[model samples]
Target chain A: MRRLLRVSSFRAVLVYLGLFLASTGIVLLFLHGQINRALTSNNDKAVWRDAAMMNQSYALGGLSEVEKLVAQQSQLSGVGVYLLADGLGRYIAGNVPAFPAPADTQMQEEGWLHLRLQAPFAEARARLVRFDDNLVLLIGRDLSAQQATMADLARSFFIALLLLAVFGVIGGGLMGRQALARVENINQSLRAIISGDFSARIAPSSSQDELADLEAQINQMLARIESLMLAMREVTDNLAHDLRSPLTRLRARLEKLSLSAQKTGQADDIEQGLADIDQLLSLFTAVLNLSRMEAGTGDMQQQKIAVKPLADEVMELYQAVFEEAGWTLDYVVDKAATTAHIIGDRHLLAQALINLLENALVHGVGSPPHLTLSLTRRDQQIIIAVTDTGSGVDDHQLAHIRQRFVRLDESRSRPGNGLGLSLVDAICRRHGGQLHLSNHRPSGLRCEICLMVRE
Target chain B: MRLLLVEDDPMAADLLIDRLRCDGDIVAYAENGEAGLAQATQDAFDVLIVDRLMPKLDGLTMVRQLREQGADTPVLFLTALDSVDDRVAGFAAGGDDYLVKPFAYEELRARLEALMRRKQLAQDTMLTLADLTMDVIARRVTRGAQEITLQAREFSLLEYLLRHKGQVVTRSMLLENVWHYNFDTQTNVIDVHISRLRNKLDKEFSAPLLHTLRGRGFVLQSADKLGDL
Candidate 1:
């Protein structure tokens, strides 16, 4: 419910409904006032008509005739108020027992007076007429019926407004949910694409709405991107095959020459040539692997790999190397991470960890060159961290160190192709994970490969 | 030893055939899979070196056809395709070994020898080289009368070396056969493990059996035997 309320379409509907109800309420209030005025005006006109008739009677006959007319009007309709009073405002003949208003009350426009009367006539509008014999007549109509009619009008208006609000909320909720679902479909497709599924696409809706148009445009873009990626992958594969064949033939020729040169004592130079060619081949292999992994075209044999055992194997491979170098090596697995398993290519994961260890062995120089390989679980991810007690890189250089052939100034003299970290980063990305580099606390460089833990 | 080489590249094939002939192995050359398959069916060779990409028929299909015909000769796939999937496909098609392009000659020789020795070594519970003996069933090792202790990985490594005794087994062969890892490490991790195993097996012995052949690889044979070579 809260998420639906956050939808822009739903909020817009609410705003529109609120404005509609407010304007409707104002219109109904205006109509109510107009109706009340019409009823009161009608009542005043009837009172004036009665007063005029009484005045005519007084003119024709005398006070006795006017009193007889009032008695007849009172008997004909119970709603009518008729009074014939003598000079001092005492009632002579009428349904009312006494004058409703005080003697000092002044008349309103056109000789109209509003009266707040006693029991049986709650409110009234009246007009007074003066006779030549110092007699006064009062004529008015009861207003309770007008008040009742207005109350009925207000009740109906409230019911109509309540219905509008109820239906608006329900309709707006439905509209918001529909829009949210459409957007979610697009999101799910994009997420699949991000997770290395190049074929994922949003399903086209049948309706010719704006959202459908957007979906169509996105599908076109995805198809274009997929084709471009496929082309690039083919180019890389072809390049690997084309370039490696000649190199392989050259190496074979060199090996053959080196064999003949052994008796002539020229084998050392040819051996160096072979080593150089081997280095070139390794560089080619690293570049090819990195590119394929980054392009998400690398073939992965995914399986459930337990975190602790994988780490242990990598550590065992490197433990002797570390010991020979007089470097202390520590391996730790957090209790929680011991049982953590991730679905990924085990060889690639081991390769990534091995790269980190090699990076440490080559660049990570310290008093004793201590190294630590640890595994820990954080939320849904398993972190495999390698820390070394070496002088860390500059904070600015840390960001670019993972790029291809990005060796630091001091490390240029070292024997490295500088593609190790880039390969590690590519491998991590292929597994739907990430490679993070930071300076370890107190000293040294820390590299972490975080992979998602699968249930 | 007799070997058959089925490769598309004439220059590479020529160089490889010359080297293998110099090494005292009889080599048969076929320019493509079609010719190679014909020669292989007509004659008997100890090992078949098939390149993956070839004209007329690819190496994988050739090997598949060979296996379907019930030819049990060991086959090694030589190709530029180094991906895990490609290797799996190679093995699935009945190739006994896989070697990526631009590999060292020693690496290829080591793997080919390993493939040829695979069937013979499977039935042996006791592996012996010189006075060093390993009882595979008991998981015990002894040099003459001294009982040797080895970690699980060290024992496996030594067992593989013993299986390929007197043969030059490259570091990659050790990694693949012993550790079962397909990727390479930047450092010489295998050398370190080998050194540790060497210390335990040869330090107190009169003759050093475990030997490192510099750029070639490692071999397990009596020092007298090595001097003869």
Candidate 2:
């Protein structure tokens, strides 16, 4: 019984039964009150009528005749009459061999009828009358027959209540069990999915219910996932073709050049060939790395990397480059113990930062020719800023800067494929972070790499 | 160097044949696995370079057949299949090295050299580079005859840098080569060990060797900017 109530649907059934039984019980109580009143009053009238007829018989005949009838009244059926006179107050007639006077006293006096209740015959009625001042006539009927009828009614009502209780319990249980079975089936399917079987799905129900609708929705979600997987595969195939084909051709060409230089003993040709090949390989591999980052590979290596020190290191390494390039380099590292830790791969992070800084440096020599690098932490985020007082970009150009191999220069070229900001964007996203670009105060393009500070 | 180059695609075969000859390795090129196997039975080479998914016979099946017949020549696989599972499959079929296609000529040359060198030395080996020597069995190192103590990881790091001496090994290279972790190339373990390694290599010496090229990566060499680089 305890376990049955533990199920919510089962508990709901019990609550329904409780409400149902309470209302039915109230109606039954009201009906029982009405029936008892009506039945007792109805019996009083019938018994009174019979008592009046016996009184008439007593008045017509004298006491001796009455006495003789009374002596045989036990043998006589239907009504019983007993008479008690003024002086004796003893039984003078029918079925009362001894005096049991108090019950019929009210009937003996007047027209009012009385019903007396005793152990077995709870519904008994009587009436009496005084005839010529010397004799009293009493007629009373013990309604043992009426008592049996009321007992039968009570028994039948008990049987009805018993059957209702038994049937209600079984019906409620079956309904709860059916509902639970559907829920359990859905739960099993969901568990299978959680354990990595994305193909697992809830069994569809024939009935058009909310459960069936939920199953249909889950299947739709799974379809979307499957399509995404297919798209990823297609991208990988295209990457292999486009990146590797040119690379293979370029490598073969370089090998032939080197061999020719060796055979011909041309010193300048050897040096030129080596330089050109190195440049091509570097550029190709960089582009490949950037594309790979963009395609959303798993970021499996993550650790607590202190950002300020890392940013400082990059600054130090490039400081000489910045100075020799005739750019005024400025830096403002936060003094507020800005050693914020973030979960990331250091090399990837460094690569992205290097791209942004180099972009700033290259852009610096073009216009106002000054660069600024800053690292700071604010509100559970690590922000590294690389600002250059070059031709600061407008909103449109700022958005375009992160597109693949996008360089806005109409001049010869900017040393790279213009993928610096794009690589920055990709690396930030891999760390559950983002790259935000905005105009620095009055001048310069500010590249902000915001990452989740490790807790 | 004598070699067998097996490839199915006509374009790929022509390019590879030209490149290997330019690299000055005597090459035997086969377009199918059957012809390649017949050549292997008739001749011996320094290395066997096979391409996967060939006509009539796949590369892995041919390699397996060769191994079954007690042919023990070192095999380097070249395939267009880039998936990690494909690599495992290639190696499981008795390949000695796996190279995804579109490789740089220099990378190919370096790998082939390493393969041949390792074969000559066998497994129980101590390795050496200019001014640095390391015992593989003892896990010990000495630079210019001066013995140095290093952490276990530091020893491994130095060993890797020394092995690939003069080449500009990227952080990714060190991560995979020394740490046996091919995946996460972004780890700072490479950076930290490079720092520790520089302190031991050239901190007390006249010049620093582990030069961190600005946007590139760490390279193991002398402190001065090498004129070629």
Residue-level lDDT for A205 in candidate 2: 81
For candidate 1 chain B, the 10 contiguous residues with the lowest summed lDDT are B220-229
Question: lDDT by residue for model 1 over A391-410, one digit each (tens)?
Answer: 98889999999999999956
Writing each residue's lDDT as its tens digit, candidate 1 over B1-229 gives 7899999999889888988888899999998989999989999999999999899999999999999999999999999988889999999999988999988988888787878888888889999988899999999999898899999999999998988888889988888888889887778899999999999999998789999998889999988888633
Model 2 chain B: ten consecutive residues of lowest lDDT: B180-189
- Chain B TM-score (each prediction, in order): 0.97, 0.77
DockQ, all models = 0.77, 0.21
Please give the distance, in angstroms, between residue A314's alpha carbon in candidate 2 and its true position after superposition.
20
Chain A TM-score vs. truth, each candidate: 0.80, 0.48
Q: What RMSD value applies to candidate 2?
A: 11.6
In model 1 chain A, where is the ten-residue run with the lowest total lDDT?
A100-109
lDDT by residue (A29-95, candidate 2, tens digit) is: 6777677768767766765665565566666886665556556654666544344444355656555
The clash count of every prediction, one per candidate, is 0, 0
Best model number under lDDT: 1
Against the reference, the lDDT scores of all candidates come to: 0.88, 0.69
